[model samples]
Every structure is written in C-alpha cells, then in structure tokens.
Target: MSSSTPVWPAGHDRRVLAEVDSTNAEAARIAATLAGPTWILALRQTAGRGRRGRAWNDPPGNFAATLAIPSGAAPAQAALRSFVAALALADALTQATARPEAISLKWPNDVLLNGAKVAGILLETTGQGGTPGPLAIGIGVNLSHAPDPGTLEPEAKAPTSVLSATGAAIDPESFLDLLAPAFARWEATLRQHGFAPLRRAFLDRAARFGEPITARTLRETLTGTFTDIDETGALVLTTAKGPVAVQAADIFF
Candidate 1:
C-alpha cells in the first residue's frame, strides 16, 4: 500500500466484523437503517458469494467487504456503480503494487493483475413496491491467497493474489483504508460528472480491449471484438454479423 496513511472518506461509517456469512447479506439486512454510506468489512467471510450464484472462496487475510449506499434511482442507474467500484478497485490495486501498468479492469466486474484475475465485484439492490432501495456493492480481493484452479469452472481465468503477484501482503483492513477513499472519490465523480468520464477512465484501463473474446449467455454464445461499453453499461462487441450489446453474460478470454 501507499507509504502515507489512507484517509477514510468523510461522513462514511465503517464496521469491521470478526466474522460473517457474507458482507453483502449483512448489508442487505441493515441497508434500510443506514444513515449514510457505510463500508462493512469482514475479517472472516464464511459464506461469501459471487455473480451468477457462484460460490466465492473468501479465505482469511483476503478482502471481503460491501459498501451499502441508500439510493432511490432506477435499478439501471444504480447498477452503474459497478463501474465506480471497478475504477476504485483498479486505483487501490495500482496504489498497493505501485505498478499501474500491471493493473487492468476486466469486462463486467473483475480486476486483473498481471493479466490474471485478482478481484471481483457483485452488485445487488433492495427495493419495495417496485421502488428501488439501497444498493450493496460487494467486493472481494485475493489479498493473500488464490483459490485452487481446479475449484474453478472450465475456461475460467487463473486466479492470483496480491501477495503472489506483487509480494505485497496487505491486511484486509489496510487495503480497505486504501479502497474506501478511492471509492468515495469515484462515486463523487459519478454523481457530479456522470458516467461518461468513468466510462472513459475504465476503457483506458480495460483489459483485452480490441481483443477477440467470447461472451456466453443463456441462449447463445458470441465471439467478437471487444469494443466499448454503451451508455447503459452493456458490453458492446462487434460480431461477424453486426454489433451486439450483451446485457448479461459470462465472458471468456
């Protein structure tokens, strides 16, 4: 991490838990009562989860936390914070490693270090009566350990850890100190300037940009050139037939 101390964002509450089933679940449970944005950190996450209902292996010494933010925007607008999270994540990793060139953001919600998967993000919102509620932005980083490759699905990118990749063994709380402020800055940028700037920033650090990759959805599989993220944050790719915008898919590179 940085040599200087990290400044926690103003007006944000932080809770460090010794153990929890999942930070996201806890965030969902307490979202309604939150007075302001809160960062929940779990030293030991027993039952963490990822996108598509996949089981996330969050060993001790890793980073597993969620930012619970109260919001009333439409799901689509609120969902755009994934980019905010990703950008913040990239910034934190770069700051920790001091090697900006090694940090890159993957499509959807992943962070790559030295071209391997090092972090992932999951977004969920709570609502009532069709009105959007608070949002939980769950983030996990392989700070000290990478799961066994055999445990992952076929064609999944190999996992790496901050310790392995950069020799920086960051404690969960120390990393959070770096992350929470970065997230606050990015969130402010999003609120003031909008997604255009964030999209451009993300694209600048996008992994496999202009590269050929495969996106697999429930109905079909598409292979195309990774192009741009649309206004609504959909993955835009140039396929053999034409350009396609994929709302949800498992991308394989």
Candidate 2:
C-alpha cells in the first residue's frame, strides 16, 4: 500500500494482508482489543463467506475488505451500516469507471453494474442483547475477474467485473484507496442525518423496485410485489397476505 493513499477517519486503523481466511473474521479478532474502527484488506481469501453462510470465492487480485466500527446503536439500527456501505461502494465504483449512470444499488446491499452483480456487502455485529458492540462491514467487489455465470449459486444474480464492464482493470489496493474516503463521507452523513436521507439516496439508485419477486425466509416463502423499505430498514413486500416487513430473507426476481 502506498503512503499517499488517503487518510481514513481519525480513529480508524488499516491493515493489508496477502491472504486471510476472511477479512471479517480478522477484523473481529482485532476488534476484541481495539476500541476504534479497524479496516482489514486481504489480497485473497481462502474461506470467505457471504450472507447466509454462502461461500465467497475470493480469487487473488480482487477487492476483499472489512471495516469494524464500535457502535452504540441498537442491533436494528446498527444493521443500517449495510446501506451506508452500499452507498459508499457505489460512489467508489462510479469514480473508478467514470460511468455514474451505469451503477445501481440492489435492495439490501448489492451493487450492480449494467444489471449484473459487481459487488456485495455483508454486515455483522458482536455483543449480546438488543444493544450491540462493534459492527463489521464486509465488502467484496469483482474488480479484475468474475466467476462464470453458470458457476454462481442457484439464487445469486449473474456476476460482472470492473474489467469486464469498463474494459479497465482495477486492483484491490487502488479500489481501497478510492473506497476509504467515500466510506468516511457516507458514514459521516449517516451520523448526521440519520437513515432518512440515506434511505432516500439508496432508493434513488435502487434496482428492481415495484417488481414481482419472491422472498424465502427460514420459515416459509412468500411471493409478492417489491415495495419500499420502511423507516427501520426492513424490506416491505406486498404479498397476498398484505404488506410484509422482512428483516432478513433470500429474494428472487
């Protein structure tokens, strides 16, 4: 990493690794002793996992990183970090590709480029009870390479990459340099204006809103029309049973 890369927030510490099991796990290990925020970047991950414990195949030279921040918010509020991180990632991608119009945000925390998945965000937290401890925000972007569309998990969207979408290669380090400052700005916005403004911004760039979709929860599956997210950041699905506020689920369009 270059010394001139960009300065992070005041209490933020950054670590770059050649390889790791998972950046989120590494960030959590450090968060145990560190009081402030810590950013972890790995060149490659042997055992990266995504939402719902899905395997994240992190090839070398792609972007894989995690940010762990100590938070005082309740668990539901802390979960909102996923949206903030998603907005920041979208901003970074727009700067990298210089095509602001091609980038869009999917519900929850996925970033899409030309209707394909370019990046995904995973948010995890520590501590017990309603109030949580540190929150780990994990982000993975397909920069130089993307998996074959046929190889993606059954429910995952077709994947794309920065190189494929823009015909310009982007390395992990350079993407981090672009991402850190963007993240800091969005984090500040969230702290100041709360989720209303952030929610609006997210919806502005949201993909596939008001479309028919299926949401599969642990208990049952519901088919409904896609609707807006509520004040608490839950996905509101208008099903035959009426409006359903889904806190967590696998969605398909």
- The C-alpha lDDT values of all candidates are 0.92, 0.85
Best by lDDT: 1
Cα RMSD for candidate 1? 1.0
* Prediction RMSDs, each to the true structure: 1.0, 2.6
Instruction: Please report the candidate that would top TM-score against the real structure.
Output: 1
Cα deviation of 100, candidate 1, in Å: 0.9
lDDT of 1 by residue, 1-253 (tens): 7798668899999999999999999999988888999999999999999998899999999999999987666888887888999999999988888989999999889999999999999998878898988889999999999999999998888999999999987899999999999999998998899899999999999998999989999999999999999988999999989999998888998
Query: TM-score of predicted model 2?
Result: 0.92
Question: Lowest summed-lDDT stretch of 10 residues in model 2?
Answer: 1-10
Q: Least accurate stretch of 10 residues (summed lDDT) in model 1? A: 70-79
lDDT of 1: 0.92
Off by over 4 Å in 1: none
Q: In candidate 2, what are the lDDT values of residues 1-253, reduced to their tens digit? A: 2234555567677889999999989877888777677789999888888998988878887899998886556787788888889999988888788888899888787899998999999988877776677888999999988878777777788899989888767788888888888898888998898889888998889888888888788998988887898999888889988999988887777
